[model samples]
Target chain A: MSQGSTRKTLASIAHGRSGDKGNHANVAILGYSQDAFDWLIGFLSKEKVEDYFKPLGVTQVERYLAPNVRGLNFVLKDVLAGGSSASLRSDSQGKTLAAALLLMPLPPDCPARLFFKG
Target chain B: MDKVRIGNACGFWGDDPQAPAHLATGGNLDFLTLEYLAELTMSILAHQKAKNPQAGYAGDFITVLQSLILSLKAQPRLKMVTNAGGMNPLACAKKAKEVLDQAGIVRRIGYLTGDDLLDRLPDFIRQGIALENLDDGRPLEPFLSRVVSANAYLGSEGIVQLLEQGAEIVITGRVADACLTVGPAAWHFQTPLEDWNTLAGFSVAGHLIECGAQVTGGNFTRWQEVPRYESVGYPIAEISSDGSFLLTKPQGTGGLVNFETVAEQLLYEVGDPSAYLTPDVSADFTSVEIQDIGSDRVQVGKAKGRPKPPLLKVSLAYRDGFMASGTLVAGGGKAREKAECCGQIIREKLRQANALPQEFLVEILGAGDSLPGIYQRNDPPEAVLRLAARDPSKGIIERFTREFAPLVTSGPQGITGYTSGRPQVREVFRYWPTTIPRDLVPFQLGFL
Candidate 1:
């Protein structure tokens, strides 16, 4: 699929998973290809993810890179309210967080050619 | 079997009951590992033990073992390692022996002890071991009375010892879930304790398949890509002496095993890829690599690690309060609005009666209640309204559970789906993660 003039979601270039570790939830966004991985290193940032999930009242967001798998793990701090045992939310664990983040619109800065081609 | 073939039958306590038999027959595995202990499972087991002395360990183990006795007899060399011993390994092992003896399959059922630290907390505290909460840094003084379960996560040493002593089935108390594989891999290859790299590799393999079908596409992001998600195959890690491994499911089984599945599980819920701290070793996930070598087989290697951490992680659960949750589905137009109003009506009624819970949440599940503020939808054809509340007193929570029934008749027009009766008030045990020095607790392997 070509990266068109119309903006695409991050799901266009990458896939991910999110799970909880106590009150913190880590989301690993893996690039579908090497080109997408290179583009994501610059396009997706800790600041960007934090701002996106700010409404969830997370305290902090930290990013760790695993180049072997072309993954960027973003740990959202204090995001799960009280976490699994104590959380009152339907998702006591933040299991759907990755799906929520996947909806984010890809910024225009991401050029059309840099998009992943499967 | 130079490369030990280990298959995990079940991940958590309530996982598939038939998987043990399926794996025992179809996997052709040298060892069948069952992981049952979760962070808060020990607390639940503690309460069960308090009621009945022989009720602490996982009951599913006996039932699953009973069903798999013939399969185990056919494959006599096949061994098993499980933390299903929960709060009581002796009782679990005793039950296992009874089942095996009855089936005429006599084997030395080995169970490890000395991991349960509930009784030792005061002694350690008197000796100045604070046993502080790792997350909040709070000391244990205030919550001592409320503490229900306290267990140190033992490493692979106990299981390795049991295996070395010719035990076919090894049961243990709250060892790190990954140690189910680590112990067998270390014993099979005689891997040194100080050999961090190899241990790390074993730990990586263990963690990948630790959650049973997770590595075989249970939680894969691309759900459609997995051929059969419902009846998906359980994972089998064929680990070599060098700690490298290949991950595959039983042949003709439904599921996919590729680099994505391996990579996803490798970092699932792990904070830092470079430092995944388990009791055996702090595995460096970044150094690991996965390659799909055709036919549903994925080879993983190059996992590095540092020496085992001096302090072992501890999970202590203390009774915080009582909590109850109930759900009701509403249909037709404007269901979301009616559900919201009904929840507010219930809370207002509770407030008027002076029994309102301290922590209350009303979630319109279908209308994006899972992610709350992150994802919001306008309205759906029907939505389930969930009411969850927590309070220090049980009587207060008892009052909250009664309100859900009245809403079905008096509140909204299409309020239904309450056939399960009033929600039971459950004692809430908040997780306290901390660490203790490795030398403080010693491991002992005993035969049943």
Candidate 2:
């Protein structure tokens, strides 16, 4: 885990959006640059995402690479409760999962400043 | 061969009603696409057809057509492709023809059939075609009787056939959403059926603008970067002969189109980017590239693809159970605590009466129930105490609906936003995703 000086978040280098596919949800996080993308490919792992979203009952996570877009799409399986038809949650489709994931604290020795300019 | 401009006006059944007229009147489009169906939309249209022989299609297309009449007449070169024919394309096309005739416009109309597979499923089963669920290996046997609507996702072949037959307008049932753009691209470009790269490029473009304003800033991750959302422009993909396209909106319209917007939409609801399977082509979204040339215009390069999958995906809906949700606002101080108490009180009462539903879910709206255990905001001035229940027994759901109103009079001191009364118990038609072999579907195109 990163200390105060090295602590960083995905919001510094990436942005994403999520939606439902049946009961499953896909959260795609795209890097702001190739450097950020390279850092993300190694930093963000399936086990990390599965661990982060475990509180929401995400059974498993499958990571996929989209090098053309410098993005990684993580499919959070069975995380939408029962998806649109049956999920009783306010965001039944897992539309906010990406936003929630972007807030995850990065591992140690990350950049102190945000990577992408506004 | 010149570039083809395709604009999608209607994203779904209940999108902005003003979008059709806005795009039709202003957009210089060769083709206009209206996507009206979603996963469970057919089940609803099926229920409609069961009650009335004359109704099953998307009626709003007729209402929207009335607004597009003048534009369709003015732009004679512009054609329309739509899957607005939910459960019934014939009825929808007939209604559309009547609307056009009334407007004194004589454009050729076509309707495609054979996507509906409910009646044919039994026959396919007899022939040893196991319609097993794509998600799980469960055979359709146990849920056969409960199936309400089953439609195979037809590809662009039928749509292109209709266009080749000199049909100015194309209406289809249960075609893939991307096929709306893919069909027109293949017809206009005259691309070979085996040209998977070209089809993949068009399919990728179609997926971009199919959701209307999605690629042009709707649901964008950087929503703050988008401007003038009140009049957000619909998307237009000016596709070239070589499968490259410029994604933009009508000039002077509101919305942002850039690399960020384009990149986010490329993977919306998609799984493996390398194998984005459709009936037209198995597109590789990973090979697609985008360049933000300027404001409100992005150049999307040629996409890669493989041969189409042997089978077509099926979207089936069946009777799941009855469910209802009712909300009450717990206000002032200690809103979260008060809402929690109200939920406990309801659960206790349900337990005492032995009328507990099979599934009972309680959510405090303002307390970050969206993320549940992850994101939380403990102190809020007010919060919505929502009680939702789903069960096989109609009696259980009906009883669950009654429990909300009683909370207003008997529960916490701050609880008081139940003016809407008890929730209505409605049938839940859960989606069942599966696939069938391409040979099993006989998608036929006919002129009106």
Q: Interface RMSD for every prediction, one decimal?
A: 3.6, 2.3
lDDT of 1 by residue, B124-223 (tens): 8999899988767899978888899999999999999999998999999999888999999999999998899999999999999999998888878887
Best by lDDT: 1
Residue B246 accuracy (lDDT) in model 2: 94
**lDDT of candidate 1 over A30-93, digit per residue (tens):** 9888888888999899999998888777989999999998899999998987888788887777
The C-alpha TM-scores of every prediction are 0.97, 0.97
Say which candidate scores most in DockQ.
Answer: 2
Candidate 2, residue B328: lDDT:
93
Cα error, residue A44 of model 1, in Å, equals 1.9
True contacts kept of 2: 0.76
For each candidate in the order shown, give its overall lDDT on alpha carbons: 0.89, 0.88
- Going through the candidates in order, what is the number of backbone clashes in each? 0, 0
Query: Each model's DockQ?
Result: 0.54, 0.64
C-alpha RMSD in Å of predicted model 1 compared with the true structure:
2.2
